[model samples]
Target chain A: MELVVSQLLTGLSIASILMLVALGLAVIYGVTGVINLAHGEFVMLGAYCAWFLQTEFGLGLIASLVPIFIVLALFGWIIEALVIRHLYNRPLDTILATWGIGVMAQQAVRLMAGGELRYVEMPAALSSSVNIFGATESAYRLFILGLALSLFALTWYIYRHTAFGLKLRAITQNRDIASSFGINSGRVYRATFAYGAGIAGLAGALVSPLKSVSPEMGTTYVVDAFMVVVLGGTQSLFGTVASSGILGELSGFLAFHSNDTIAKALVLLAIVILIRFRPQGLFAARVRT
Target chain B: MNLTGKSAQQTLLYGAFCVAILLVPLFLDDAFLLNKYSRYLVFAMLAVALSLSWGYAGILNLGQATTFGLGSYCMAMALKLGTVPVHTGSDGLPDFMVWNNVTELPWFWAPFHSMAFALMAGILVPAAFAALLGWFMFRGRITGVYAAIITLAAMVVVNLVIIDQQRFTGGFNGITDLAQFEVAGLAFDAYSSSTYYLVAFCLSAVLLLSLAITRSKTGMILQAIRDQEDRVRFFGYDVALYKIFVFAVSAGIAGLAGMLYTIVMEFASPTFLGVPLSLSVVIWVAVGGRQSLLGAAIGALIVTGVQGALSESETFLESWMLIMGGLFVLVVLFLPKGIAGAFEMLAALFLRRSAAKVPSVSQPAGEAITHGEGAS
Candidate 1:
């Protein structure tokens, strides 16, 4: 019972991170119809921002999060305007273009940061452990979980209740019709892409303390986040949450029994098999074309 | 095969290319330079393989390195067994296996003891895997970005599994200190002129064979499918079968290249299956012009040669990736047809200018040129 309880908690913590990383990908892809392969680089840039701020200006991770988000969002906005705007209709080309952006970003970071592993100190307030139902848990982990859920709630409210989201939805449904209805789809897409990038930056800043900070670190996170988004169904936000939870638990349980690398391989295999059977994904929203 | 003027020009190009490759050793006396060129030849084969599926069939396989790595490992395992007693010991197990406390040779490594078996497995295994994967993906109707993501995911899975199974696969350090490739009684040293000739010969054969495939009737149908899949299906073509066949064929070529890569490099590492290498292959093909087999091959050679030269300098080494990245972006945006496409455009312009002097002679030729452009 104790093992199961602890395992569940661990799974939730993992799920929170997955959710945070994937939320931006889900938003950008769902709305813009661009894969944004540079999404991972955005995460890497966010982590670098946190490291730079903490070391250079004595800013804490928590304090630097907002600035990191803004910086990444602005960067994303410029990329979209310069590159993605031209290739919106060509999905495959966008993948290649964004990948080029990602490679450039990674190399730029390597040149700037000297290719060494940089560390960020965890916040002192969340450094302690908390007793939860007889299983000791890191307060930081719980905080991440809380923050993830609140972010998801905030996103949902904005998506479902806001006028801007209504325009976004209209554009998603039919770009021609949305424009006829006076919605500036290009502007909405830029904003959506930027927002997604900002969230991804936040995820990177948050995850830096848990994992080592390096230019290559984003590659793993991006792949993992892609799996979560792909498995959850491309268009469903709630699906992203549920699928992340499922994958996190599965990986945590497998890692417990075996090891990290093996667990990762197994989880990838499972996702591949699952997608083979259900290509539309676990929670595909029913919509008529 | 069609004795058209364009076809004649293409044939002349191929012949010139073959002669240039064969005559390299006569011009360059340095063994080290010859070996480097040999490696570049292998990369050219890989680019040609990618061009077959990505350029012709419109299947962008992001995991091209997965097949290449598999083939390399298969060949490496055989060579590892043939290494000197100092590395493998009298028992014939690889040194890493002994280090990992693996007392016996794994079952998979058993067949690789024979050079013939390893060579065949190098090509066949990756081809078989690609056939199965292509079948699965095409049957499911997974196209575009989904296919790219799945293949990328598969590559990562394979990479992780190989790294995790340290005892059998040598983990991160990989299989090293491989013996020279020997067939019958002749040994092919890595830096020898003989090895260079072997690579050049194989590359020419692959290039010619691929050109033949691209010109065949089936090739026409494949191009039709690439342009309009639904229309081709409507015309009674088995779209999935065609995709699988081309994908498998491409993988087989990549596997052959991988074996040659192992021969040239003298070792195999997990980096062979890494994302960066795989992505780099796509960049090479795209930069060369994915629609032209020879163009793509030449693109790989030029890019790789430039990279090697640039890596010699300290500042260039630091910013080579950034430059490549910028090149990739500029190529995709402004030069989507690549260098080959640009060359074709220039040739067409010259032809049109000469034809303008005699309007009657240019009519049918102009139509032909436009027809070829439309097909691409």
Candidate 2:
């Protein structure tokens, strides 16, 4: 019973990071209808930026998040203004183009930092494990859980009530109709893209301490994020959070028993099977207008 | 002036190009350059395969490396079995397989002992896989971004599977150390340059065949599918079958390249099937010009050459991928038609300027169309 409880908690912790990384992917796909293949690269850059700030400037981990978000946000905006702007009408082109961008980002990181994996130290406060309900969990794991839930609440609040969120939602429904209503669709597109990237950046900052920071590590998570967003249905942010838990738990539980590679393969196979059957994804169908 | 005239000129140009390619080793007696050119030709074959599906049929196969790898493995297995006697143990199994530990060979590895069967299997396996995958994908009416995603997913999954199945297949440490061939009492290794000549000879033949296919009515339909798949469907053509046909044929060509690649490199590893390789193929096709077979070939050669040069320099290795990414962005933004197309456009402009001074060299429109690839 204790082992199961421990496994569940561990799964929850991993799911939290997955949820955060996948949240931005879901938002970008939902709003812009582009998968933002570079979404993982944004997350990757975020982690690197935070690590660089901490290592170079001797900034505290908490203090490093601000610049990480800001830098990635600006980067996202530029990507939107330049390459992504022209790709709005061509979803496949956007995917391939962003794939190129992702490669560029990865190679840029490789060039700057070298290909070796860099370890980021956790803040002292979040480094230790804590006893909970006669079981122990890493303090950092709990911290990540807190971050995920808070972000989930924050995204929910934005989509539910905020004016910018409303405008974004309106654009998602029909870009032509939304633009017709005097909504600056282009600005909204850029801002939403930046926002999505920023969230991924924040997620990267939050998760950097838990894992090794490397340029290519993002490919694995990026693929996981794609699976989560698609499984949850690209139509809804709530779907991402829900699906993240399912996928994360499933994968974690499988990994607990089997080899990590096989577990990953099984998960991928499941996604492929699901995609084959449910091309519309596991969310609301809107006639693809 | 019309399509027939253009086609005739294209045929002549293609014939001349093939002859020139076949005669390369004769003029360039240097063994190193001959080998390099031969490998480039193999890469060009793979590029042609990629262009057919991507540039014409509009199915961007992000997993071209998988098919290429399949072909390589088939060739490697066949050669390994053919050279060594069965049940002799160490001499029988390839070096990687011996290291991986297998008491007995798998049943599938049986037929590879025969050279002819191995050659056939190398091409057939990839073609079969492509046809089956294409059928399922197209029948489901999956198009555009979804198809791209599926192929990318296939690459990841296939790579993982290949990594795991180390028993039957030599996991990451792939099959290597293939023996040389002797056909019809002819020493393939004559002059140490004949091997390269053989490769170059085969490549030109394949290139000619590829050009023929591209000029056929089938090629026209494939290009039509790329432009507007739905409209083509409305015209009462089976879009799925057309896609499957091109995809299968492309996979066969990729396999052929893999066969030659094994000969040139004398080894096959998981790196051949990795995402990096697949992405490089995409970059090559994009840089060369997708619709033009010659352009795809040139793109492969140029990019591979760049990669070769870059890897040799530590500084270039660090920054080259970044430059490639930047180039990708620039190409997409500006030179969407690719390097070959850019050259042709320049040639046309020069021709226009000099038209009054020189007599009109009559060429058919069909033939001229080879040099007229644009974003139509």
Candidate 3:
């Protein structure tokens, strides 16, 4: 029972990180209809930014979140304005374009930081494990789990209730109609994209301490993020949350039974089968075509 | 008569291309350059396969490398079986397997001992896999980005499996120290002029066969489907069948290329099945005119050539990746049709001028759309 609890906690922590990464992807994809292949590069950029701040400026990872988010979000906005904005009508081109952008970003980082893995120092307070339900668990993992769930709640609240969410939804439904209603669809799109990018930046900053910070680190995470986005209906925030938990736990459970690579292969095979059966994913999005 | 007149420019260009490919050995007699050029043709074959599926049929398979790697491994296994034990003294089980402590050869590796079976299996396996993938994806109407993602994820799984199952598949090092290619009494040595000719012959034959297919009625239907799939489906054509056919043909071509790659390079590794290689094929196809078979082939040759040349230079090595990325972006941004498209435009202009010189032109510009895609 204790082992199961610990495994669940581990899975939840993994799900939390996945949630952070996929949230931004889901946000951008839902609103703008652009599947950003460069999303992983943005995550990598965020990790680098966090690493730079923590090492050069001696800032704590906890202290670097807001600034990193703001910076990367603005950068994402600029990218949206420059490239993604033009390719809105062409979905296939968006994949190719973002792929180019991802490649450029990856190479740029490699040139600057070099390919060596950089480490982020975890905060002293959360480094140690604490007893929970008669099982030892890392405090950092618990904190991350809490952070992930709360962020999901916060995102859900903002998306479902706020005025910005209203405008975003209106534009997503019908661009011309939304514009006629005095909502600047362009600005709304840019903002939504930036917000999504910001959330991705937050994901990178948080995950930096847990994993090795390298230029290619984001690629691994992005694949998982994409799976989450696909498995969770693209337009649904709640679906993203639910799918992340399910996939995270599935991989965690499998990994516990087998080796890591085998577990991943199994999870991927499961996803392939799931997608074959239900391409719309686990939850259907309630949207007007 | 109308077809002959329309394809006059195309016929001339194709003849020149064939001559150019055939004459490379005469211009560069160095054995090293001959081998490199042969490898370029292999890459072009991959690009052509990609164009058939992605450009003509509009099915972007992101896991093309999976089929390619599988094919190469098949050929490698067969060739590995031909040779007796190097150090094993354990009755010919492949050096890596012997190293991994396998005394007896596995059943799966038994059939590859026959050259003909290995060759057939190389093409058949990838084609069958593609057909299965197509049945699931196309039949279910899972087109566009979802199809691409599924293929990509599937490939990653295959890559991990190969790497993880090292004892059977040679793990990360892959099947190395491969035996020389021999059939009956003929030895297709990598550095030999005959080997280069063999590759050239294969490349040319595949190119011609592909051209014939793309020019046929089915090819027209595939392109029509690419433009407006729903319209084609509404017209009572089985969209899934056409897609599956083109996808399988594409996979077969890629598998053929992979087999050639193994023969030329003398090894097959997990990286052959990697996402990066798959993406590079996309890049090559996109950069060459995705819709043009010849363009895609040329694009692969140029891109691979440039990469090889740049990576070797001291000053350009570090910036090579940046240049490639920049080229990819610029092509996507301004030149979506690619360099081949530009060449086509120039050819069209020349044809237009020539037509003006002789006023009695029977065929109208309506056939230009069909014949114009022939090549530059």
Candidate 4:
């Protein structure tokens, strides 16, 4: 019972990280219909920022989160305006362009920070383990779970309730119709892209304490996040959450039984099989074209 | 079947390319330089393979390196088996297997003892794998970015598996100190003129064969499908089959290049199957002109040559990726058709100027422009 409970907790923690990394990707791809391959680089930059702050300015990870978000969001906004905006209709070109942007960002970070791995100090308060039903869990893991849920709630609220969210949805449904209804889709897309990038940055910052910070770190996370987003259904927030949970649990369970590498390969195989049956994804909403 | 001015120009260009490639060994007597050029030719073949699928069939297989890596590993296995008994042990097991305490040679590596089997498997395995993957993806109607992501994901999975199974695959260090390729009891040394000629001969064959395939009736239908799949399907073509065919063909080409790569480089690392190399292949094709097979080949040659030269300097090596990334972005943005497109534009302008000089041939000039545009 203790092992099961602890395993579940581990799964939840993994799910939180996956959700955080994939949330921004889901938002950007869902609204803009552009697969931002550079999404991972944004996450990498956020981790770098966290490392920079902790090392240079002596700012705590928690204290520097907002600034990292803003900076990454602004950076994302500029990228969208300059490159992605031109390639909106050209989805394939956007993939190439974003990949190029990712390469440049990775190289730029390597040039500036050197290729060495950097670390972020965990908060002293959340460094200890907490016991639940005789299963000891890291307090940091629990905190991340709570934070991820709250962020999801916040994102859901903004996506469902706000006027900006409505415009964003309007554009997603039909860009021409949304424009006819006087919605400024370009501005909304830019905002959506920025928001998604901000969320990814925040994820990077939070994950930095757990993982080593490096320019190439984002590549792994991005691939995982993409799997989450793709498995979840490209345009659904709830789907993203559910898929992250599924994948995280599946991976965690598999890893417990076997090993990390085998678990990963198995998870990818499972996703591929699932995609074969349902190309529209697990949570696709039916609509008449 | 008519010999139009456009076809004549294409024929001329192909002839010139062939002549240049064939004449290289005559001028460059340095064995090391010849070896390096052979590797560049292999890269050009890879670009051609990518162009066939991506440019013609609109299937941007981001995991092209998967097939290439598989082919390389297959050949590497065969070569490793043929290595000196010191490396293979008294029982003839690979040194890595012996180190890992593997008592027996695995079933898969057994057949690779025959050079013919290794060579055949080198091409067939990747092609078969690609065909199977293509079947699944095309049947599922996973096109565009989704297909690219899936292929990329598949490559990652394979890369991880290869790295994890260190006992069999030689893990991160990969298989090294391979035996030289031989045929009819004649050894082809890596730095020998014969090896260079072998690579050059294979490249020329691949180039011409690909050109022929692209100009065939099936090729036209494939291009039609690229332009409008739904329309082509409505007209009764098996769209999925066509996609799978082209995809498998490209994979086979990539596999052929991979075998040559193993011979030239004399080793196969996991990096051969990694994301960076796969993505670099796409960039080479894009910069060459995805729409033109020969253009894509030239693009790979030039880019690989330049990268080789640039890597000689420490500072340049450090910033090379950044430069390539910037160049890729610029190419995609402004020069979407790439260097080949630029050349075509210049040729078109020259033709128009000459046509204006003699109004009698203006009709042929107009026809040539349309043909050029259509081909591109």
lDDT, candidate 1, A1-289, per-residue tens: 7889899998898999999999999999999888878888999999999999999999998899889999999999999999999887667778889999999999999999979999998999999999888898999889889988988988888888999989988998899899998999999999999999999899999988888899988878888888998799988899999999998998889999998888888888777777767888899899765
Clashing pairs in 4: none
Candidate number achieving the greatest DockQ relative to the actual structure: 4
Q: Which pairs clash inside model 1? A: none
Give the distance in Å from residue B125's predicted Cα in candidate 2 to where it truly belongs: 1.8
lDDT of 4 by residue, B187-214 (tens): 9899978888888888888888888888
TM-score of chain A of 2: 0.96
| Interface RMSD measured for model 2 | 2.9
Question: Backbone clash tally for model 3?
Answer: 1
What would the per-residue lDDT of candidate 1 be over residues B1-376, giving only the tens digit for each residue? Answer: 1358788789789879988999999988888998999999999999999999988988889899999999999999999988875755577888898889999888889988899999999999999989988877887777778888778878988898899899999999989999999998999999988899999999999999989998998898888777777788899989989999999999999999999999999999999999888888999999999999999999999999999999999999999989999899888887877889889778767877786765555457757743543433
The candidates' DockQ values read: 0.53, 0.45, 0.46, 0.54
RMSD of each: 2.7, 4.2, 3.4, 2.9
DockQ class, candidate 1: medium
Better candidate number, 2 or 4, judged by lDDT: 4
TM-score of each: 0.96, 0.89, 0.94, 0.96
The candidate with the higher lDDT, 1 or 4, is 4
Please state the error at residue A170 of candidate 4 in Å.
0.9
Comparing 1 with 2 on TM-score, the higher-scoring candidate is 1
Candidate 2 docks with a DockQ of 0.45
Q: Write model 3 residue lDDT over B215-303, tens digit each, in one string.
A: 89999999988877888999999999999999999999999999999999999999999877887898998999998888998999999
Clashes per candidate (backbone, < 3 Å):
0, 7, 1, 0
Q: What is the lDDT of residue B289 in candidate 2?
A: 89
